[model samples]
Target: MLDYSLDISAVERDLALPDLVAEGEELDALVSAEADWTQPTPAQGWTIAHQIAHLAAADANALIAIRTPEAFDTVLKQREAAGPHSADLEADAGAAKPRSVLLEQWREGRTELAAALRDIPLDRPFPWFGSDVTATLTVALRLMETWAHGQDIYDTLGVPHPPTTRLRHVASLGVAGIPLSFYAAQLPIPTVPFRVELTGPEGQTWVWGPEDAEQQVQGPALDFCLRVTQRRPLSDTALQATGADARKWLEIARVFL
Candidate 1:
């Protein structure tokens, strides 16, 4: 059986604000330097500018959820309602603003988000979805979202994002959520015992499940992370999944709601 109670502290420890800031800055630079007539990104007809705007909006929402306590639901609803308008604005030829302005807004949103996260007590309980969650989990969720969405921007620009230890946060969370994905994929629950060996950022390996398991999956941590997050196609990765069920599970990996 998959363990839902896997340790998440590793995810917390991997949340390096400096790394995130640097990645965000690189993405901003990429967006700003791109030519106006560049091909549309995989996100429909949206251009690079729209992607940065969406990231800014997402970061802003995360900050509100972390800091306001009582207003998260309302704030999220407002953001959802504004999504269509944002898309419509991007579709209009004259509606898209300068990349510089979008970059500034993105930086501002990230700044607010970082400050909010820094201020929250790690042990404090916060509202997430319909349930209370720890501040650390909230941070992990934000990191996951940022990294995952950042992949879209990076892929659209054909840029390589060097793997960081922070990615392990998403990987750990992603792996833990695998059983959920299995169920969603309408696959049979594996009855055999297995092990997952995930290498951490610093060449440290995190072993889960029994030591003498009948099956195992192992590979470079970054590829596994990318696969689980669905940021990269599973066929494009080097992760090796032994045993029938474990391989099938990796093929349908997903993390978001």
Candidate 2:
């Protein structure tokens, strides 16, 4: 059988930037007050400021990956040497700055990164923590990070995060992240393919993998997104798993390394 696949980088990029910007804006609005910045979020020991700072740092790193691969490799090495807490240390450093400075840096960095992502050749591989990724995947990860961290900010402020179509990007990334989830947990990657069928915010169905796959997961897209991002525990979500691998996947699912 002849296999045919189409590259959807352009489409993903188009949706990604706007959705990231929108998600950023929503979180930005909640942090206008000084007290809001220091408030502890759902992520243990993370404040609203830390969430934004992490994003700012990630955007800066992404810019380096796109603009100067060699430099990004250096940055990655530095991060590795700095150890696992490097991310928290980076966020702490950024959060220590005045709110205005951190906010401006995040805003500027995300904007610059988005613009750079647009001009890059989609086929060109960009350096990342574990491996190189295409520009399209890079932008989608940005969107996913923005949305996931934005949830922390919203939880901090006790505000309801209104569901939007943009979450489809997060859900898509979550689905793609299944194997990574296993790898991160030091578990063997499953050979059997699994199907995912989610109910989108607007009640539309979003499906991935093969329809005939014996292992399957089904749930609201938001629940799956929250699960894969590790934002919500499996017990807290309404997701259903039809196979052993599927059930195990929900237990260890995570989009980040």
TM-score: model 2 vs. ground truth: 0.93
Candidate 2 whole-model C-alpha lDDT, 0 to 1: 0.83
In the range 187-251, model 1's lDDT, one tens digit per residue, is 76666766888777679886767877767888778888788777778889888887877788788
**TM-score for all predictions?**
0.78, 0.93
Per-residue lDDT of model 2, residues 115-141, tens digit only:
898889867877888777777777778
List where candidate 1 sits over 4 angstroms from the true fold. 1-6, 10-15, 35-38, 76-97, 186-194, 199-206
- Candidate 1 pairs with clashing backbones: none
Q: Listing every candidate in turn, what is its Cα RMSD in Å to the true structure after a full C-alpha superposition?
A: 4.2, 3.5
Model 2 ranges with Cα > 4 A deviation: 1-11, 33-35
Q: How much is 196 displaced in model 2, in angstroms?
A: 0.5
